[model samples]
Target: MMAPNNHFATLGLSIGADENQIKKAYRTLAKKWHPDKNHEAGAKEKFQEIAASYEYLSSKDRREMLERELRKPAAPAPPKAPQSTPQT
Candidate 1:
C-alpha cells in the first residue's frame, strides 16, 4: 500500500514544489507510468495519484500551505572542528 505522503515520495520533491516543478515531474512520471504505456495492473492508479497530487499542489491555497511548510528554518548544522597547525 502507498503511504499517506506517497505523492511527495513518488515525485521526489518537497510538498511545497512550485507549479512548474509539479508540472515537470507530473509529465515525466505520467509518461513513464501511464497505463496506456505500461501494462502493469497498478499503472493507472499510480498515474491517477500523480495527477491528483499535481492538481492539489497546483491549487493556490494548497500551494501557499506547502510553501509555508517549506519556508520553516532548517536546523543549524553542527560546527566543524578546528584544523590542526601545519608543520614547517
Candidate 2:
C-alpha cells in the first residue's frame, strides 16, 4: 500500500486515531486550512485529507479502543515554583 498522507504524519496520529482525537484534530486543522482562511495552494485538499483520515479512524471498534487508550491517566505534570524577581 502507498504511504499515508502527510497531514496524518504531522498530526502525530495513525490511520488509527480515536473518534474524539480525529474530530478534535480535524476541527483544529480545518480551522487552520479552510480555503477562505488559508492562502496555500493545497489548503482545501489538505482539509479533505484530514476529513478522510478522521472517517477511517472513527469506526465503532477502533473508536472504542482509542477511548480506552485515552482513558489511561496521564502522568502528573512536574511542579513549578514562582520565579523570583531579580533585584534591579
Candidate 3:
C-alpha cells in the first residue's frame, strides 16, 4: 500500500516520472478533484492533497531527495543476542 504522505502515489505517478509527466498528472488530478468541479464528499481534501503533492514534487531538489530516499536500500536487521541457559 502506498503511504498516505507519498507525493508520487498521491499524483498517481512513479518515482521516476519526469517533469512533463508530473505536470500532466497534476493537471489531470487537479482538474478532476478540484472542489469547484467535483462535489464528492472528499473532493476538497483530495484536491488539497493533490495540490500539496504537486508543489512538493515540482521542486528539483525536493524531487531528487525523494528519489534518493526511494532508491535507498532497506537497512539490515540487527543480529539477535545469544540467549543464555539457566545453570542448575
**Cα TM-score of candidate 2:** 0.50
lDDT of each: 0.75, 0.66, 0.88
Candidate 2 vs candidate 3: which has greater lDDT?
A: 3
Error of 3 at 71 (Å): 1.5
At residue 43, candidate 3 shows an lDDT of 98
Q: Which ten residues in a row have the lowest lDDT in candidate 2?
A: 1-10
Better of 1 and 2 by lDDT: 1
- Best to worst by lDDT, what's the order? 3, 1, 2
List CA RMSD, all candidates.
7.1, 9.9, 3.9
Error of 1 at 34 (Å): 0.9
Q: In lDDT terms, which candidate is top?
A: 3
Q: Give Cα distance to truth, residue 11, candidate 1, Å.
A: 2.0
Clash count, one per candidate: 0, 0, 0
lDDT of 3 by residue, 1-88 (tens): 3423568988999887889999999999999999999999999999999999999999989898888887777677799999999999
